[model samples]
Target: MSYMNLIKEKDYLKILIAGVINRFGDSIDAIAMTWLVYSVSQNASLTALNFGINFVPTVLIQPFAGAYVEKLNHKKILVFMDLLRGVVVFLIALLTYFQCIEGWMIIVATFLLSTAEAFRMPANNALTPVIVKKENFNEAISLQSSMFRLSELIGTGVAGIIIGLCGVHVAIAIDALSFFFSGSIILMVKAKSYLRIEHQNKIFTDFKKGIKYLFHTKCLMRICLIGTIVNALLVPINSLETVLCIEVYHMGAELLSLMGIFSTIGSIVGAFIYPYLAKRYTERQFIVSFLLTMSLFYFICILNKVFLNLIFLFYIHLIISYFSLGAGAAVLSTYSSVNLLDKVDESFLARVSAVCVSLCTAAVPLCSFLVSFLSTFINVSDVFIVIAILSLLLAVLYSIISKKRWLE
Candidate 1:
């Protein structure tokens, strides 16, 4: 089915709109939050710490959240989480507007936001299959991915303009409003309760079962490991992009926003192309090739003076690298979701998703910390090179593993 038809489904349409609105707000908030923290502290480590805090709560909460989602109403969980986040974010905006916000407050707010996210993510993932038809599932995911990128493109562009004109507080207030609007849209989705009555297991027992299933499923395990490694290494790169643009490139928020726009455009293109590519290549082939190519672009990005105009060259290289990374990410997300959905029972979906997401994100804080520590000792450019090399090694290692059928 076409993307239009997929969105025409009432439940899927609600979910899609809610997701897009939330992501748009999130994209704006991402830039605003990073800029706010960095501007306040003028410390890269603290900035990285702020980014790290967002994921740390998920690492600790997602498994439990997933287990509970199986027993609770997904819609209610989503709505409650959104409302909670909206309140917290708006409070933060008020504090900021009053000049009462502190650096630590941002970190605390991020942690709270992530706490809601820990449950909301798994619930959202589980809700998709229930609403979308089996054959249209992949299309729905791809469309969602495309919309995410499109939202990011628009949100980041608007954020840069807003921050340039009105400052971060206003941008944040907008994000807060987005959350409330997203919750209202989610309330419009009409789906039967996905609560599984047959499973009366304890939460810890369900968590354990999820972990056991993940490890026993070698393909899923391999994918999870690779994802974790990539996420860990990539966190620093993303967490420090503003630093790269402002500190290293001698630019301002406009440049940072431009980079975000270009990256999201690349992601949109990748998401748009995924369905066709999935038909032509095996998941292993698509993932390996994309990773390898993306790593190559990262290497190129490290060459600061490759062209006569260094800054221009950097922009060109960064855009290409982001494009490749976006494509790879889209493919990886689709492959992981489709494969896991087929492999795992529906009752276990939320728990499995939670565990997988947690595992993939577990090292983010530590890695962000590592980057912050390394920055104190090394050039940020040198850190980028190190990430590139590690990524290349990972791609090569995964290629060998695929060849050996270790991922089978």
Candidate 2:
């Protein structure tokens, strides 16, 4: 079935709509949160620390969450986590408005928000297959990606104006509202959830089994390994956008918003093209393209430095460069996600998917730390070039190593 037919399913459509609303809010928050951190600390490292904190729960909690999710109603997990995060975020916004927010509090907010995300991921990974047929996974995921990108584009484009006029608190409040809306919508979707399992093992035992299965599965392990490196390379650049705008561009929320819009436009283009590309090529081909294009995105970071000397050239280069970055990110993520969902059995998809994600995201925090450390010695844009070179080498290295019995 085509993407349109996939959308005709009422339950899937609800999930899709909820996702769009949720992502729109998240896109705004991405800018708001990062800018708030940089504004408060005026230090690149701390800003990077805030970014890294978002993933700490992934490493420490997701495997356990995955196993726990396997025995519960995934729908309930999704709804509950959403509502919990909505409250936590709203508290942060209120604290900000009342002028009692501290740097540590912001870190805590990120951690709490991400902890909820940690639970949400496993539940979601396990839940999607129940809603859509296996064959439609690609179409369904791609459609969501495209929708997410469009929402991100609009939200980001608006965030600059919102933050400029209303302040970060208002933007944060919008995100909180989005979470409540998303939770409510997901609650209405009817789906078969595995609420209980006979003789279910203890959570730790199930977590161990998921890790063991991941270690034993060559393809899954490879996927995780590749994802880990790709994510690591991407994070430094992604995490430092705030620093780049404030320090390099000497611009504020408005410029960050512009960058976000163009970058998300790239993501939209990538998602739209994925189905066509999938039809013509193999998974390895997609990964190969992702590798090169991601490196290109970084190399363009170096180019942006030159254009900074000329204001006019900088804006032109930024739109083109960030667009490339966003597109490459979308393609890799959509394909990898579909492949991950396709490879696992529903019996313990949450556990398997959680372990996969934990492995994949393992290095993200370290990369953020690296960004902080390296920024002390070199220019942030220099870090971008170094990453570009690293990504290119990684692509070449993986291409040679995976020539056979690999992603083909």
Candidate 3:
């Protein structure tokens, strides 16, 4: 039952293998799905809608997902989710192969996949502490994250060839296979039983209790709010990035892929350095300082686009922006248990995670909608400026309010 021993090299290797398998498959869609949607509809609006529909489920289901995880078996839930995701993605691959993959099918499939993802995420997040030594938790999270980014680097290149030769169907088939690969690895890793706490009350009552606890805990609320505001304000920037690059800067996917590479590099570096940084500063301080640094960088990126050639400055700006994001995220994951982690019973972990997921993702669609609407009137630079301002404001406010409880 002791979680500490799981930090051993052998155990970490097991988790690393699982992550690699999961991320390799998950990376197939970095470019394929977006291209597929556009190919089907040729409408940017529909493409945005397709992306937004996925978040809708996250907004609605995350809290419950977290709660359910706490009350159920985390491993079994992960197994089932992986199995379901594999099936759903396989069907999509079949549709694509038949040349009958419609826009609605993509939307519906995205929603279903996201819904399953919502359930899987909380268990995965909370399960780390159970399997990894508490001290190695940050490293595990960073390693896992880097594995995902690494997979993207490899998968994007691989997807390019697959899409160019065999088309999106084959790429999607690889994605489905990746899921099964990940699931098999997960099934092989032995860990202590992750049973949910038995609650005698009704489901609704239990749900309310988890929600109330999340809001009532000052420290946890602060952490959740920080995550929520950051995602809400920044989601639009990510959603609109491709358009900004193409329409505003006259760039292409190649440059965007380079940005992704730099971002992943920064993440790998940050993962190595953040643990050292954490020993010296509180998580709240790190978040605020990094948030401010990145917000300013984003502003510069937006403004730089106005006077310079897109080719010259675009890569630089993207590198800085993504580096900042990667470093910030690395630090953030280290303190994943801040407020609600130890306070909740094992049974409520899923629900709590779901609520957190809902808050974190709820505004993604709204942000995407705003970007779609705003682009009609304003330039992409204006959109970036707006997001930068929002991030700076939230960062400053969170820092001031959470100073006393920075490390709590």
Local accuracy of candidate 2 as per-residue lDDT tens digits, 87-148: 99899899989989889999998999999999998998787888888888888899989998
Ranking the candidates on lDDT from highest down gives 2, 1, 3
Query: lDDT at 224 for candidate 2?
Result: 86
How many backbone clashes does every candidate have? 0, 0, 17
- Residue pairs with backbone overlap in model 1: none
The local distance difference test score of model 3 is 0.69
lDDT of candidate model 2 versus the reference: 0.86
For all predicted structures, in order, the TM-scores are: 0.94, 0.95, 0.85
Which of 1 and 2 is the better model by lDDT? 2
Q: TM-score of predicted model 2?
A: 0.95
Off by over 4 Å in 3: 1-12, 157-166, 196-200, 300-314, 337-347, 376-379, 395-408
Compute the lDDT for candidate 1: 0.81
